[model samples]
Target: MAQQLDNDLQFEDRFHRKFYYLRLSVTDVCNFKCTYCLPDGYKPTEKKKPSFLTLNEIERVTRAFAECGTSKVRITGGEPSLRRDYTDIIRIVAAQPGITKVATTTNGYRMEKNVKEWREAGLTHINVSVDSLDPKMFYQITGENMFHKVMSGIDAAFDAGFEQVKINTVLLKNQNSQELPKFLAWIKTRPIQLRFIELMQTGEMDLLFQKHHVSGVSIRNHLIANGWLLKINGKNDGPAQVFCHPDYMGEIGLIMPYEKDFCQSCNRLRVSAKGKLHLCLFGDHGVELRDLLSADEQRTELISRIQGGLKEKAVSHFLDAGNTGMTPNLASIGG
Candidate 1:
């Protein structure tokens, strides 16, 4: 028998999936101009747009989601750490009733400086993006020369008493693919888990896919050839497939958003930096939550809007079929 969704669940659908995870992009400002995420020498638009939601607004939206049964929320951005009041935002989300987890995805350049404050503000988990172990290659990928700073941030995160810290590496052909083994070996010495992400069609990276696409299958094969036996434990509710490598202290995760489609079990909905609600990562359209908030609607109407958006959700994205022009920039939409 299929379980029926609760009436109070604000983001349930006819497909029997209840949306519980919200990825909120706090800001679109970032220090690193990574080749995959942004174009080189990219400049901000002159419209003077506000890139962050106010603390009160973020709290209100988070409370609404909690009331509708969301248990996990991840704060993301071009770089969440770049936000001035990021810690305050973290505290607000963490203080919400029924929120079991509060996490953030960052570039790790500022983690060392803010690790203590973030931990103090009730951040439960941290995922840092580190593409390469070699300093030169790291600079090449992120267009930054601060590899040591990022490494120090990882150490600081551990020292600050975060239970689980994840290091994310976007696997790109001929760029950092050869460094995976070394990257994995280096992470074993730290308390962090290693997650190797397959390049997805988003941002400026999609423009270079033909020249740099590296599939998770290729990464898996490389690991196997290197004497690491990978046992696929199970699929995560999100994109990543968790794997336990034999004799390795830490686990390896493969996020194959390009090669494999895990949209069937996806229960995530995104709230953009601008406050629009997205049903899926590849969704071009979004329900204007900001407009709803500004209209002085009651809580009931706000809940109705979220539920309506969930019903309108598509089952999967078309990008897996070699289409590259569908998804928005990953920074605009949280990862």
Candidate 2:
């Protein structure tokens, strides 16, 4: 029952954290310029960076991670669907020897037209980013008025036979935080769990923290105060602290890295669109793997770096501690 690529290698980190989950970003390009992600008046650029990893590099790196005990892999990006051969990449990775589950986090812009293809390609899980239910508010948050279209895509995902769909909502202060209670009631009619994520200390801080960042603690307290009974089920080994209410139709998840740092139980490593292996989200440094991938270096080469970097992986992110160094943008870091 163990996840394995070929029954040869098992990788462990210095912190004794086994890398069973890996999040890989296929591209840094995004269609909508969300205020939290990019600054105002941000121009969309179409030029693809030459250093971005191809489907082949993603396959090789994924194989390496699988060899090291990565069984659950999530494809992430500015928007993973942006890749012309996105489904092809999913098929390639999902078909690997030991990969048990292949998931993706997307903006759901093109999902309606492509969910069936992705499902056929071995995509077993999905997380859609939807901040608000209102079209005007959605556009204000994401800088694009695609709320209806995105909702249609979510509908398509359900119709495509993905048993469990996850909706990721980033609750900003006065912006969409008010949607917390409403969203809880709204998602119950569906077969998906609405996960509220606490804003991480990534990208522009001045624009993100002071105005938007709402603590997960506040949200949970609000839920409890609103006559919601807490019930727990399933595994709590992942990032989100799982919660449920009997009255609600689905479930809820809170990703509070700042309030309750889960770095000690961190089980994943992230691969950026440019093929950099990031040991920690708040870590200032990363291992550049593009050169090694292009060089067709042995798996041992990449494995060696992962093993060495594990020695320096922070026990917890430095966000609250104010010790964080210059961090990469979420798109570049695969957040």
Candidate 3:
């Protein structure tokens, strides 16, 4: 453990875990603030864009990650498409030395115009967050009435011929849990994978989490009763345990963060919008890699800092055991 821990910082850490996935947040801003994620009725437009890193700075840091054997990259944000140069960032990151796949998770509001452009720029995977299909419930959870707009954006992604167009549904109690079967039926014949994510413990999220948290186990039981088959180790892009019905064209995955199932094969690290590198999802405030990258430090120095951060990653968030606390706001952390 000490041998690899002291030697390489790109992927493998002191725990002997190799990290290949990178979650890069471009903008901390989002068009919609969900009920569980934001304080009551938050509006993103009220704030100015925070100090986001330049594309060139991101390029340098991404290059450093690639040098350390980071192969998969996911571009996330409040909504990654909100950035003016998101397409350019996709092109640039996709062109990096060791980076292979460049994917984005979006709310799908601003995705209509750029799906084609982004697909052409080496974006192979797209995950759209659609928590509830009902307009009223969607608005209640996301504080946005544009449910139809997000659906259209999903269609556009398929039309644009991206390799995968997936739906990420966060299962909040009383918000969308009862609608799980209906939502599953809605995707029966579509060429998109539906993933149900358990809300992570982040920010001042405990009160809301206490009220709204639904376990993935219960959701899976409900889905199974609805006749969804558990495809053993089914196809998935990330950590979600995937499933599917005999009738559906695409699969379903459950990102069970609350299940304490992440750390064993954990393969990703996150770079927050402000340039903090998170070795674990519920990790403490990470080293500010943006400061180092912006200062024109050599790639070796940046990698060294990343190595130092990786050494501190907790074995797990230990959510129910009270070992996990809210991370920085989900929007900033690109969750």
Candidate 4:
């Protein structure tokens, strides 16, 4: 039935990559000063504060995406839980007719305390950023001393009835690259899928990229040699290439954006917190969709704008050629 719906109202790019996943940024303000993305913490602009899409705007936009056959919506932010209406946002997106999975990428700042409410609000999957399992290294990478808290939050999510939780670890060259064994051991008995994401060069992280960028290819090779078998992705799955081991309770995933043909299987589209449609994360710029989001009656035009914008979607990101486009930092558009 879902495949039939996708066939009926497909949102496919010229390359024939059908988008069934949506990465929706609820806000761009993050509290933790992660060394890679935001080293200065979240700074507000001197000009009028940027307006984030409201609850009604979120609903309308989600409805249009659902109509276009998007089945999974991943809510992202500097830290989405920072917004007071975070749970409500989850509720609204989950309530949409065609959206089956409502997930989020969070820092787990409030997860320990509020994850129960968020789960009740209809959040299906959760990815928490745990840069390092070592307390000191975690603090060094994230500039936060809340390693224990975030760990507790992961535990709390399980207690709240979450089946499998995914942990995102940004592979830093000399930092957390050598800690894979530690991560593997932690996930061995737990239902946690540890994802090792290759750090790519954004416009703002040139020097850091040169110094600490570790290719996820190395990790993928390690997994393959260690008897882990690759798993096929579901239609609504994200870009991660997953692998599982017969002995471990958890899995491993590698997200290598710099890998060749990374964009060939692109199945997701990103929307900024301010209602701008980003065709590609490393695309030159975004097309504004806020003007069409003001009223419910404009759903047709909104969907039209989305469908029209796909024509301009590039076949691949130019990261290998050293182009990061208008994306200064991941936090600006919710990486």
The candidate that achieves the highest lDDT relative to the unseen native structure:
4
Per-residue CA lDDT of model 2 for 204-293, tens digit only, reads 665577768888787778767866555543221358766666666677888987765467677888888888888877788888777667
Q: How are the candidates ranked when ordered by TM-score, highest leading?
A: 4, 2, 1, 3
Q: How large is the C-alpha RMSD of every model relative to the true structure?
A: 3.3, 2.8, 3.8, 1.2
Can you write out model 1's per-residue Cα lDDT over 202-315, one digit (the tens) per residue?
Answer: 645655777787788876776667676545432113456656555667767788775544676777788988888888777758888875554334566787888887778876
Which pairs clash in model 4? none
TM-score of model 4 (CA atoms): 0.98
Instruction: Residues 1-335, candidate 3: write the lDDT tens digits.
Output: 11222334446777787777899998777878787676553345436646787898889888888778777789998788878999999998988876777889998997777788999998988989898988998888888889998888888888899756888888888889888668767777776788888876666776787888888898787668878777664112468787777778778888887665576777789898778897766775577887678655678888888988777887776766755544756776788
> Scored by CA lDDT, what does every candidate get?
0.77, 0.78, 0.78, 0.92
Off by over 4 Å in 2: 1-8, 40-48, 225-237, 295-297
lDDT value for model 4: 0.92
TM-score of each: 0.90, 0.91, 0.90, 0.98
C-alpha lDDT of residue 282 in model 4? 91
- Provide the lowest-lDDT 10-residue window in model 1: 229-238
